[model samples]
Target: MSVATESVPVFAIAPAEDGQIAFPPAMEARFRPGLAAVHDEMLAREEVIALLCFGSAPRGEAKPKSDLDVLALTNGTEYWKRSRMINGVEVQLQVGPLQHWREDIEKGNPAMIDAFATGELLFDRTGEATALKRDAEERFRAGPAEPGPKFFQRQRYAITNIVLDLEDMAEDSLEARVLAGFMVLEALRFWCAAQRFWPNRKPWVMLRQLQGRDSSLGAKIESFYTSYSSVHAIAFTDAVLEGVGGRLYELSTDPEPVPS
Candidate 1:
């Protein structure tokens, strides 16, 4: 919310007929068994209260090799892994206990909320996911909430560290900078969301969304990732940093005032 000076738009996926979401053909072929497996897991136990599918799989941007992002809310007493692969497809779960959903919000993790805001609700036990998602959207419509000091601090800190990393990579040959290119892209993605731009959780999707926000910025980033393929790491880094040093500063520091 505070992270973006430009009004950040909320993205949501409306379900198709028959109440099922779509995936790319190859993705569905490979990923469905795993989703079904989760469905079975949820059905077999009362502890699993909800299942959600976000990112490329639900949005149908996935290619043959795409993985899934799932949020499974369970009654387990503790949180779980951030990611785990099933059937060779990596599933990035914000895997935590039921309380973690509330934590996701309170921590000012807007992307997590945007995931639910835009994602397809795969399973909702007695409408658990549906009800909570509506509440999340209400907050979204209320406008971007400032992610607060820690969120801003973390984003700025991470960016600072990455610049230092670029310095370290400079002494090395092309391969090192290539790796650094990836790191830069990641930083760019985080900065976008940290500024409340909210691209669904994928590199290309995020790139497109960035382009949507500013065509020149988008094309410049895409050109590097495409042409040099990170061979020109310094240029790539510079191009990426152009997105920073603007409204992000204002959004990160100037939160909406709290009434006493």
Candidate 2:
């Protein structure tokens, strides 16, 4: 559970009602049919024990155009294919060889466990999946984050991603600008979570967080950044980073333990 001093950062999403987080409603409705389709395929293979949606769709935070995030626990990967062109999109489905699938459950990668326990089950066979999900949820809630190394280890990917995202902001492409802004917010959330400071997963939070670091950038993003407009935010972000002389390094490499 110990993370390296230079591990990636972790992010915490705003807690929704009942500790729930999810994709936007419109996006969820659009994805439900697809979930049905995937479930049907699983049943056909007889390999799927349970299927649940994860990520923004289930979390109620998805935009109009978000991809589906599915967690499936199957008996084996024998029935699974590496790259199936499902309607031309490459859906990255992680499968475990039957025995490995069980091992994943034992090892606590209960990604499938959490999805089933907290998620709306699109399909379930034999009812064992539901029981497994409930058991997994109990374990997740009962356990405390081991803190220190554990917390830092979880943050590494997020921090690394944030760095790359900043690099993307320097691009001239519209898509790059839009994605860059999201990455910026994501990076901010990671930093905040590492310090146990939670930020709302919406724009207002972004503006507020940026304002603490750079007022001008905050003003620009607030005025120009919109649910409908990312270009304005991108331009302001460029200015903000420049003004700060560079990006903010939220972590120190002193190797000293963080003071409680």
User: How accurate locally is residue 124 in candidate 2, as Cα lDDT from 0 to 100?
Assistant: 49
Which 10 consecutive residues of model 2 have the lowest summed lDDT?
A: 8-17
TM-score of each: 0.58, 0.45
lDDT of each: 0.60, 0.50
Tens digit of per-residue lDDT, candidate 2, span 98-199: 345344545656354454445654454545455555555665565423347534544554444455564655456676656766755654554444433333
* Segments of candidate 2 deviating more than 4 angstroms: 1-27, 77-92, 97-102, 105-117, 149-260
Return the top candidate by lDDT.
1
What is the TM-score (0 to 1) of candidate 1?
A: 0.58
Q: Backbone clashes in each candidate structure, one number apiece?
A: 2, 23
